[model samples]
Target: MSGSRSVADRSRPVDGKRVVVTGAASGIGKGVATALVQGGARVVLLDRNVDAVTAVADELGATAIGCDVTDEDQVRAAMRGAAEHLGGLDGAVNNAGIVLNEPAESMSLVDFNRVIAVNLTGVFLCAREQFPFLADGGGSIVNTASMCAGIVVRPQPQVSYNASKSAVVGLTRSLAAEWADRNIRVNSVSPGYTLTELVRSPELAPQHEQWSSLTPMKRLADIDDLVGAYLFLLSDQAGFMTGQDIVIDGGYTVW
Candidate 1:
């Protein structure tokens, strides 16, 4: 106990950290940004939906940037802008992603490539651009993967999504190993079916019951349920962790 920090000190692990979150217009990204702000971190919210993200940032008293992660130039510029706003970066959450539920046999190449461009290549671009800002003092990068990365779900043919997410894990491990020397720890979070705006839509609501029953917890996760993992990955408490994926699936993958 002589060298130990108090629980109070440990409780606000991300306090004063400079952080950035992509896809911050809604869903998990917005949830994480809100938590970061509440935890006393300086945050920059980026999303392709400029107006929406701007509103969220304004509400949270954080900076906002219009960025499309799949575009390299945009990613680079957004990172620079975020670092400038934060004065430097301590952590980043690369969470911009889209899923297309089409069977592989009928899925057009254009559609498949779109998913890869955003979910896989976009992550690479963000991490690459964030390197310079973080290299000086070291930082963390949390990529949002999905439980689909590990196992294919039934009733949905999202071959592209599954493939892209699986690659994210591989990318995370590669970056973690390569950047360990620079103190840039890389990690990923793979969430199970979560209750996001899109999921609550009338078109997708019918599928919720099936998804919930399959989960061990008998329900979908709230955005709140997954934000803690992101906060931990970006905090000093997880200082020794890297190249790992924290799956927040409520035991869905346990089977």
Candidate 2:
């Protein structure tokens, strides 16, 4: 068998599967959606950025719905909207998050709450709404966590971001355990400093060179590089894997 043949075989379809991806307008969420579509799942994009979400859905021929995940009502409505648009829902990726840099001593309550609202509360909202849709036949869920959840950060502070993401890991484990008998698999992916909008911030740009050098891969990850783990968790390949956190950091956490 040729190498090309093996590659082609690996690209098999995930037909008849339905997936909802929040934060689908950009970054890692967008990449995950694209990969699901390529693998033959029908995808519904939920994003607070209506225009970008619609544009991406149009480009991918998937359905798009406007949603502010931090709001319970909006999150419920968005989940319903996606279920209706896609005819059903089988899986979800809770990838919506926000980050704010502040020294712990100086971090205001408002800033801290904002990050927690979107990164942590948003996950709760989505998972709460997803239950009814996913319970029947069981389904998969993958949350976007961060390397900061497991490792310490230095030089730049994201105390709020780190705390919220750590909650995500806890959420994944609890949900996975609760839903295990029901066959609803739950997992999380923790990424290190990857090439995303967050990395281009003026505050963090100076550290990019250091971050890259620190990684064993010696490069920042492309958003797409995280897709395979998602596909696995959503597929039978990882049917037995749940309540786990998969770290994809280009080996940045090894040291």
Measured against the true structure, the TM-scores of the candidates, in listed sequence, are 0.97, 0.94
> In terms of TM-score, which candidate is strongest?
1
Model 1 lDDT, residue 82, Cα = 96
- Alpha-carbon lDDT, every model: 0.95, 0.89
Candidate 2, residues 10-52, lDDT tens digits: the string is 5553556799999999999899999999999999999999999
User: Model 2, stretches more than 4 Å misplaced?
Assistant: 1-13
Give the range of the ten consecutive residues with the poorest summed lDDT in model 2: 1-10
Model 1 lDDT per residue over 34-84, tens place: 999999999999999999999999999889999999999999999999999
